[model samples]
Target: MTSSFLQGKKGLVIGIANDQSIAYGCAKAFRQQGAELAVTYLNEKARPHVQPLAEELGAEIFAPCNVSHPGELEGVFEAIEARWGKLDFLLHSIAFCPMDDLHGRVVDSSAEGFKTAMDVSCHSFIRMAKLAEPLMAEGGSLLAVSYYGAEKVVSHYNVMGPVKAALETTGRYLAAELGPQQIRVNILSPGPIMTRAASGIGHFDELMHHAEEHTPVRHLADINDVGHAAAFLASDAARSISATTFYIDGGYHAISG
Candidate 1:
């Protein structure tokens, strides 16, 4: 269970906010399974929280990448190109919606809010995939994080629902477009967890409680569960898998209630 499934693999991991971030969990799992990483911090304010985690994982390239900053996203790939030369996989776990839009109904979400959410949460993955394609000389994986709300209605999950829906669909299309080159693309849909990102969602505690009570597993899945699943999907072990909305949600997606 702890073999070097990803030994020798190298790639960038964007969106690590802190030790509790889903990206951090996945990066930790990737490291434990022998994959070297290039991690990013959003800004100087986030640097302190993310620096130690990146160092703990022995990340080879730790850079500041606020995707909204012009050229910052491209700069991440550039650094990776310089340090690793080639990449095997990438994990994208960033999403954003203005607090007002996140708390408002989808129908009432402002055009700017919807656009901003889609741009950060969905389009960013496509951008990363496009940048990563040339570097993945030997077939590789491109993973994005999603949520069950993308498929079904969840209380207080407003604008992100549509944003994630777009994100999942984009992954499928990227998988198709990049499949010929042997670049596998997929999305990870995890159940509610107390992430800083999730804190933006209104009444998040109720969402977590609902997931814990209703999900068949009788508990919410943690970031580590997402990490292990992400590691497997990104590893050679999942070479044949692509364009999937892989769920690490304790089977909550299976419940219709």
Candidate 2:
């Protein structure tokens, strides 16, 4: 709640679509903590949804970017350079999988779908970090969202589970490579939360219910829970922590039930 923690900080939040988005929550929380914000929308369809949110947040920079496109990624960094000169934080909350692949068994996942999932979910983070590293002259924090499915299979999570596993592995590698620069790379794995993307997964309601029932907190995590965790990890408070994946699943990952 106190803005002093992030006073004078600047950040870029990629993948905000609407208020319900985890990225949106992180953006809002970062702003409340006094961080200047910039946002990226994937395409024209999402622009309308993200623009108003950016406006509300008083974001100085709003750009259209597709992580799959190297040109777009370069443009985003260029825009950030033009506006802020340097970046203190980056939030990567982007992932994708074909709707058909999301409902099928992992064995049924097509090679193309699997590749697309890995490109979007896993590789993009690495690409983003590579691009952001130079701009983080004084060192910075990079945060990405993963899921419990990365380590344990969740029904219908399908190709995304593998993508997340790869993402976690990438995070560790990046942390090691970037630690000498004082740049931190970490993944936050949150339990099921009702987001636009979650709706596409089969039997999402049942998954939510199961998570809540089994978690020690007896409740599923909300966007704010994720947002706050991200803020802390992105802040000086977590300066010593790196090469780790923090589970924000309300202790669900530990429960056998």
Candidate 3:
């Protein structure tokens, strides 16, 4: 059932590429709970896919944001500042790595590829937190997507494992840094699910099946599951929670096969 858990809240959602994106799931759930939204598309090529989804969610601010671009990321926040004046939450759900580095072992990955992966997948969250902080004057939540690979060695998760590890640690530190202001920073780690981003991982199908089979629940979660968890974290319900990794992996992270 729909509830007004986030009624009157205003936030931004970055990293939605298409309908199957985790950011889309979060935006959908947040809207169902009555949160006003601002969304971003990567570029012109992605605009067609994301704009419709933003329209469907009634997002008041829809703009192009490529974090790698000089001012694109800043521009989105600037628009949010102009439109909303204040912010309640923000979700960062984008990650990228070149195919070669992703398919290669961490030891063999090139310096440039590793650096680019870290910059996009991990450091971008830090940049978002910095940009989102001032707008969250009334105290708000900041969330980023993480994975079990951050904590353990999952086959085919090579370079990203370390990248996510950095992200998780970054969230912890941000949580502590922002807590005094009543701003919360957290990471949401979900089990293997086929996302446009995940398509780059080598042997992804094998990874997904292994997760389902070994997971205590014997199943995996979908985008909606991650979305709901994200909504809860963004809501007043989790006011005291900060600097933590909230897992929506259906017992997969707890078991060993």
Q: TM-score of model 2 relative to the true fold?
A: 0.97
Q: Residue-wise lDDT of candidate 1 within 1-257, one digit each (tens)?
A: 25588989996899999888999889989999999999999999999999999999999999988878889999989999998889999999999998899888988999999999999999888889989989998889999999999999888998898889999999999999999999999899999989999988889998888788989989888989999999999888898999999999889899987
Query: TM-scores across all candidates?
Result: 0.98, 0.97, 0.98
Better of 1 and 2 by TM-score: 1
lDDT of each: 0.91, 0.90, 0.93
Model 2: how far is 13 from its true place, Å? Answer: 0.4
Please list the residue runs of candidate 2 whose C-alpha ends up more than 4 Å from where it truly belongs after superposition. 1-3
lDDT score of residue 1 within candidate 1? 28
Error (Å) of candidate 2 at residue 44 is: 1.3
Between 2 and 3, whose lDDT is larger?
3
Question: In model 1, which range of ten residues has the least summed lDDT?
Answer: 1-10
Model 3 regions more than 4 Å off: 1-3
Better of 2 and 3 by TM-score: 3
